[model samples]
Target: MKENLKRLFEYRELLFNLTRKEVKVKYKNSFLGFIWSLVTPLMMLVVFYVAFGVIFKLRAMDMKYYAFYLMAGILPWNFLSQTLTQGVASVVMNSDLVKKVYFPREVLPLSYLGSASFHFLLQEAMLIVFLLAFRVPLTPWIFMLPVLMLLEAVFIAGLTLLLSTLNVFFRDVQHFTEILLMAWFWMTPIVYPISQIRDNLPAWAAKLYMLNPMTHIVLMWQRITYNSPVNGPASYSMSPAGVIGTVACSLGLLIVGYVTFTRLEGRFAEFI
Candidate 1:
């Protein structure tokens, strides 16, 4: 791990350049450019509002301001999902660099993380604007937003490292990741509240559901963004145990991912 850090430090400029390229390349040749980032979440917000609020009748249920609730949850969820979707292919997508370049391979995924994070910040800015427009009061809990986001970044970094390395060897890992993410997204409480999961599922099932790291992360986000009463789904509240679970799960993934990535990276060129 020290070696990886040292190498990354040495190639810090390359990492920055790559991250910048990732962001720019994404919007290249588009008149809207970065505006699409703002438009995308809005589009999803409408789709979710209709699907969950109108079609499913969540609007009459516990959720009051369904748009606010959905937007708050969707922003971070997009960051997590987009990072993994792009990061998983980072190694193979840049096979030429992997086979020929001498820089740390980990930077590839990290750069993707950085790019996704940048877009996430933009989406977050939009969310804040909507919150203000809706007249939602911000509170002290808002301070916890950065802490939760940091934990999420650590969690995603770990996954990216592990998956990108694996993809070099098993090309199918990329396709498999798409299916896994689809299941993972629904398993998370992005569209609905955790309360629904607890009320509907068996006790044992709910217990297992809480084990998902994203569960805690999403709850924490809601705790920060939607903690104030605004006639929305009951504001999510996380206990001390939930905090510990999130920290432990994130760190565990990081440790395992870093170990697996470094161990397998040596054979990356051969496979790619």
Candidate 2:
């Protein structure tokens, strides 16, 4: 593992170049180019705002600056979705390079993660701009944004490395990942507040829901970015235990995923 880390460090430039290429190639022929990143989130915000905020009256439940709240969760969710969707196929998509190259195989998925993270940062910047435009007062919790982003990135990196490696052997893993993410999105407290789960579900069921790592991550995003005093208290659903468990789980997953990826990497060329 130490040698693998050293090797990956040696190929850091390759990772950066691949990440840059992934970002550029995504919008190569598009007229709007990077604007689409901002647009996509904006569209989701509008639709969700209308549906939940307007129609369902979630905003009426003391959730001021509800649009900001929605964006806070949606941006991170989109980041995870895009990373997994592309990362799962990263190895197979680059079969030619995989067969010809001798560099770290982990770079492929990490590059996709890098690209998604780049777009996620842009979307977060746009969200901050919207917040300022609307005269919403920023809180000290906003300073925690970088720490939160790093935590979320670690969680994503572990999952991407594990899934992308397995996907080379089983093509169905890629398709199932899409379906799983669709369900996983709803399972996490993204479109709705976590209060609904606690209030509606039985105690055992709610405890089960809290087991998902993204639940804590998304709630942390809301706690920082959507810190409306009214809705804010409810967002603090995670306890100290939950936060500690999440951090431990993320680090452990990264180790397990990297080990799995390295052990299985030898068979990747044969399967591909």
Q: Best candidate, lDDT-wise?
A: 2
Worst 10 residues of 1 by lDDT: 228-237
| Candidate 1 TM-score versus the reference | 0.95
Which regions in candidate 1 have their CA more than 4 angstroms from the true location?
228-236
Candidate 2, residues 182-246: lDDT per residue as tens digits? 99999998888787887889999998999999999888888788765644364265578878988
Candidate lDDT (C-alpha), each: 0.85, 0.89
Residue 166, candidate 1: alpha-carbon lDDT: 82
Per residue, candidate 1 scores C-alpha lDDT tens digits across 60-90 of: 7757678888887889999998999999999
Q: In model 1, state the lDDT of residue 191.
A: 87
lDDT of 1: 0.85
Give the lDDT of residue 114 in candidate 1: 93
